[model samples]
Target: MSTERRTKVLEVLKTAEVGASLLVKGWVRTKRQNKNVAFIALNDGSTINNLQLVADPNQIAEELLKLVTTGACIAAKGDIVASQGSGQSVEMHVKELEILGEADPEKYPLQPKKHSLEFLREIAYLRPRTNTFGAVYRIRHAMIFAVHKFFNDKEFLNIHTPIITASDAEGAGETFRVTSLDMDNLPKNEEGAIDYKQDFFDKETNLTVSGQLEGELAAMALGQIYTFGPTFRAENSNTTRHLAEFWMIEPEMAFFDADDNADLAEEMLQYLVQYALDNCQDDLKFLHDREVEENKNKKESERPELYLIDRLKFVVDNKFERVTYTDAIDILRNSKPNKKKKFKYLIDAWGADLQSEHERYLVEKHFKKPVILSDYPKDIKAFYMRQNDDGKTVAAMDILFPGIGEIIGGSQREERLDKLEQRMDEMGVPKEELWWYLDTRKFGSAPHSGYGLGFERMILFVTGMTNIRDVIPFPRTPGNAEF
Candidate 1:
């Protein structure tokens, strides 16, 4: 055995130096044998590319070669040489082979065959070894790095908001309660209700649905802050777009208004898209080709207008179309979808909330680019949103993209205490529960705006993948929470 330190397949493949002896260790992706030699495709999760290992049958013992099945882990010492094959540029001539672990051919679920995405989801533990998932996750990581890098470049401080919060920011009342008290025998007060005062936090608490509330507090003190963390929602939605537990990227700026917020969101998204196009070219190409093949089975009308890279380039090159909710409603009402009654929820009036179908129509058909719809009706938005001059609308914006509707949602916050309290009362949100939130407005609050981007939704859009579950490592949905 060579005493040299092991090298990752990516590192070895990128080296221009040849004829150097080295050790490469990874899981077997595929093993094929010809009359005189065996070729083993090895992957170390470093990159989508696998290093080809050539082993002469006379050199490698038969018992050792028998253990080199798919999913088996092995270490090989070899000399780097130029490959004659067209798929890759380099190959390893193995002089020493060691089987670290053996996988039973019949028992290993990930055989050398194309498995459906649904089947891969069933075995998520092993799905990362697959090409589709490998590329997806690498691209996911690249996007995550790009997000932090983007905000860092803008002098934004990264803040960690509380996962457990006492107040609901969105007022949707969809939360998963966190309790240490026994469920069978709960504490009660004289009112004959469960006494939340006896719970873990001395009051009721639940996994936060959004970090925007706390993020605002941080921004008020820090001037500019961004939060990237896990958020939970108790809404039992089992759709391709919804996840019970997922990640959110929220950024709050102290002096930004509604328009400033929209501009920042658009710039950040375009930057990330451009970053992915530059940094994750190989992985994106793999996913793009995969999506193209998958789309072949779909109806002609249901197919994507542009391929993945082209779609991303479209976003990077063009500016997002901006429109008011009223104007959007006018456009939608006069559009063909509404006239033909094709939308599931028809856009009939100004106050009606726009559905996914409506947003897609505006983004994909009307604008042919990203669309930012602002000034939604106040009653349809949260209590904290700043009321517009008209009193019927709030300074809220939702960024809609071609494949995904509302990838981002944000708004200018109510800075005046009285107006905020009045809206809180009108919405039936207890003011006492959010005393800390109101204190910011009472003392030193300024005009602030923020927006939240669902991290998985962004991944889905970038990867051209349709399902949110596939983007996340382990998805927590309505009825499924398996590893």
Candidate 2:
């Protein structure tokens, strides 16, 4: 049969019509045999839920029955029939089953019980067989599609930025240096500095932390542009939120300011949430139900109280709260929690960068929703951000979700040539290296704004998955790049 002729297990089960001839192929999830009847759960990676397959021992040969083990790939020709079982609404009555591949039940790591996320990470290949990982990855895929759709529908140009770059855009100095050299036989200059002439690129290059710089160049010409690709950072952060490699979505628009940038970020976030909720309800429910079941086994006080469904529903239903950085600082300083002084970092000053803990409190406790904090101190922000009237702060905004601290960070770019030059000089950025960038301002400078949304972070937020490793297919963290 042609590929299109094959029926998806989900489609067959969801339709609920009886006596329809169908051909289904998938890895067998489970198999249970009675005297004459056998039931099997089959999954095709099309959805989180599996399809039920009922086979009669009398009709099918005993040879085929022995081969239908858990994790085995099978192609079954069956009749789509209404299921009388309470577990599912529909099932397939198998006429003949052909085993395409066999999996040794003993070697198969996945069982019909709950497994710790840490344990699952060790066997990344087989982890998707479980319900939670499957749903998370599927939702991740759907969210990617939704993002492309959201931007494409608005006529935003999709720009591809280079993974390897020569300059540090953020200036935080967290970058994975790329080199091709024999460390044992190194070349050095007269001053004992590493010789760049012997390096592959003739100079030091590192993985990009953010695509905003290249994205800005494209936006200047294209009017509206966005970059969606992998970004790397060398920060040795072992926290749940930090990852050495992650995907970032940066959208830049010309003739836009900080407020316009905030509106776009909020709209994009809500759109993705609504899209996933609408398109992947089953997958979301599967993850939710699995989490609830897992949580129930723990002590009442120890159990996770927040519901994924409720959190996502709230995100889609409510308007994101907006506040200036000054306002956020005031609120955090005067709050009862701040008075007790339990947080690690101080939130007493306006110019101080808001730590992750402070951001959590503002979004989770004070706003009770996604909060957009804008207008940050210029010294703490990137050099590209437009300087505000006060000269001390820049027009930068960070959208902090309740569970995920900072989902998006963006700002309005400084367009004035003299101010840009001065900022670069003050930051010690190389003037010769950024000649092309300076020329963009000379040609036709327009006020432009953009933001970078951490893609994996969004998945973590939507799925309520705690670790950054859980959201990505293969996570790359510090000293954990094993494939």
Candidate 3:
């Protein structure tokens, strides 16, 4: 006969009374035995804390108790009772136990002690069992749920954007071309160019770099829309911030301007931070303690509480810093002495793209908090950004954090037909391809704005994980796609 399964460990802990007959199935984290009793720490991936199981040696049999080892999957029929021990508030008194799967302790890599993050990445399949990653991913899941809820409550339409497109959104020339024909044998045109007509799509196509353009179209028709999906970039730079394939959330509003866009982004971020803090308190606390322990061996002067829990608390309690690009440049110029010399790209120029180091310095050193840098030079920004009054800059914004530099990039789109055409022509954008997009302005258009939030970058910021590869499952980077 099949045994009965009552409730999860999280649900069991929520109960007030004990002595409830229940069945628990989970991997054994730690097991210790005396002459007549054995203590087993069981984890069901329900939460950070494990359930304590007290098994009677005489009733369960010594052979069954001996079979229990670290990482072994087991099921126990037990009655919960108030614990008299020092570890937990409640413990399970096992009446019958059965071994579902046995894991050899000699081969199991995980132990009760700490393991390096680098070491854990090598065993990616098993890293979820650890405390830090478990907490990080749990928060990630919760954040995703909160995002859907926020959009749903606001009456925003969820638009499903295409993953493959023929046009480039960022126009950065970093795109992964999609093809089916073998590279070794290809048809050549009269100019000795490879014939793309023989490709799978019968023409050139590529993985989309951003869903902002499509999202904008939907927003114009549906009023407000958002797209949350995977975006790909083929750039080869190996940095803590860059990922070849990452998730991006792009929300577009049809009748909003630059200030409205900023307000929406700020509200969304605050809501997400608060949601994580409230829903995953235990997981956040677990990550906080793990971060503290990891910093114990390092120099005390260099260590700080940069983990998820602390960062969430700080964001929830304080206001985010906001400054225009011109003022930001002035601040960076005045604070040049504190800037690292190894950063070769940031020169405090008027029309230069801000590097990660410069962004970090602005948030961490100058502001000591998250900052929104807005009104960037139009020449340096994308073609879609609305032109400012000065005609030299665009109404664009980037939200920067202390640990993670640029977590978000957004802009007020250019809705004027003539001005947008001029900008597109000057930027050498193929006007023929974007004729439909340009016609949207001719038919009916209003000032609109949106932004793209890098989902992995946000996770990295919250978890204090240094590398972008760690936060993403099955990361695809330059020359690396190992599952």
Candidate 4:
């Protein structure tokens, strides 16, 4: 390794130390020239802003200057001086330059132009070099860091659950099988059926849909824990809000009821939003401007009411409206959407499973604030949820954002062995498959609650991004898994 300490472009642009000798290496974002000098915009993936380098014809070799172009990697030894241009604070007056790598202009895909998001998705590998994706990914990193920081500050231990398991956690039967067996010639049993016993794990296994079950086991002992990792699902729907693979943040807390779970979820989300506001200002500002530009083509009624920053502040500064599922149903039933037959699924009575449209109307139109709907019907919720005394509802809660429906979903788990086993039987979850999970309640269980916040959905809301795919770095949707 070379001992030469190189200054990153972000530090140079941010500090703007005048007359300081600096060696900066980065990819050229844009290049412009005049008869007297050449200006190169360089980025090192440190920030959304680029550092400008001014090269004079007389000081630099003519041939070297000719080789500098967009997408080329270069090293510039220069003096950091105040820029003489607009839209930037500092620039480098280069005394020496070297072209580390040359990108052929003819073959380079990401030229300096206005490329559509669809076009950018086709080139996901190179999309990070663009201004929009750079800002998005930077904000994504900030949010991810904020998640661990918030949980740690709250004394929640981070847990890494197994990615492959023999039992499905979500119990939705939507899982990707994880097998290392030969596909062409599978092993057969005495019944002449494909034998999963010959697989790597010696039993049927799949990618985890959620880490909630394992998280609960840890929480029962650790008091509180959280999981932040990749989660997989086999759902085939190709919608803006769906992803075949994604990252999830699930925090489980022992000795906590449904109310406490809702409070923690609200606080954590507010903290994350505030963290982004403080740490990711430049990137968020860029995405905010990008959102404004993209919203131009949208119909007036479909556009967001507030700017990105204001919307974020609104969530952080206000109290989330907490109401029961029954109350929310009443609100939605009397709302104009239901009366006008505008909702795709009309709310006819209690115990009806709420869809995204209904959730949006409750949070955005009726309440005009973030809403936490709780005490959902047990039939619509998971079998692990604690059944209420009413015999029809469960101690579950879903926090819905204005634009994004159900940003967080969780419940106070059933801690009673008899009740849990009965519900599992009712839900068709085989008791034999989850013997270890049932052992928790059988041995030493306490009231526990947790919720899952889809990491990409939070990023989408924070960045004012319309599509969920835009927030995640190589989105995995149906029939599209390109890198």
Best by lDDT: 1
Off by over 4 Å in 2: 1-5, 187-192, 297-306
Q: Candidate 1, overall lDDT?
A: 0.92
Tens-digit lDDT track of model 2 for 85-154: 9998888999878888998888888877778899999999888888788899989999999999999999
Q: What tens digits encode model 3's per-residue C-alpha lDDT throughout 1-483? A: 026754677877777359788888888989988887899999888887888999988888787888899888899888899998988899899988889899888899988777887888788888888777777788889888888888889999889999988875458559999888898898888889988888888788899998888898899899999999999999997887788999889999999999889888988888888888789889878777877877889997788745558778888788889899998887776676435544566465677777777887788877899898999999888888999999899999999877888889999999999999999989988888778788888989889999999999888866667798788866788898877
Clashing residue pairs, candidate 2? Answer: none
Which has the higher TM-score value, candidate number 1 or candidate number 2? 1
Better candidate number, 2 or 4, judged by lDDT: 4
Native-to-model Cα distance after best TM-score fit, residue 285 in candidate 3, in Å = 0.4
Per-residue C-alpha lDDT of model 1 across residues 1-483, encoded as one tens digit per residue: 435689999899888358988899999999999769999999999989899999998999999999999999999998999998898888999999999889998999998988988999999999999988998999999999999999999999999999988776567549998999999999899999999889988888899899999999999999999999999989978789999999999999999999999999999999999999999888899988988998899999988889999999989999999999999999999999899998888877779988888888998889999999999999999999999999899999999888878899999999999999999999998888889999999899799999999999999989988899999999999889897
Query: In order, what lDDT does every prediction score?
Result: 0.92, 0.88, 0.84, 0.90
Candidate 4 Cα lDDT to native: 0.90
Error of 4 at 474 (Å): 1.4
Worst 10 residues of 3 by lDDT: 337-346
State TM-scores per candidate: 0.97, 0.95, 0.94, 0.97
Which window of ten consecutive residues has the lowest lDDT sum in model 2?
1-10
Please count the clashing residue pairs in each candidate, in the order shown. Answer: 0, 0, 0, 0
Error of 1 at 145 (Å): 1.1
- CA lDDT, candidate 3, residue 77: 80
Q: What is the RMSD, in Å, between candidate 2 and the native fold over all Cα?
A: 2.1
In candidate 4, the residue pairs with backbone N, CA or C atoms under 3 Å apart (3 or more residues apart, or in different chains) clash, namely none
Q: Which stretches of candidate 1 lie over 4 Å from their true place?
A: 1-4, 297-299
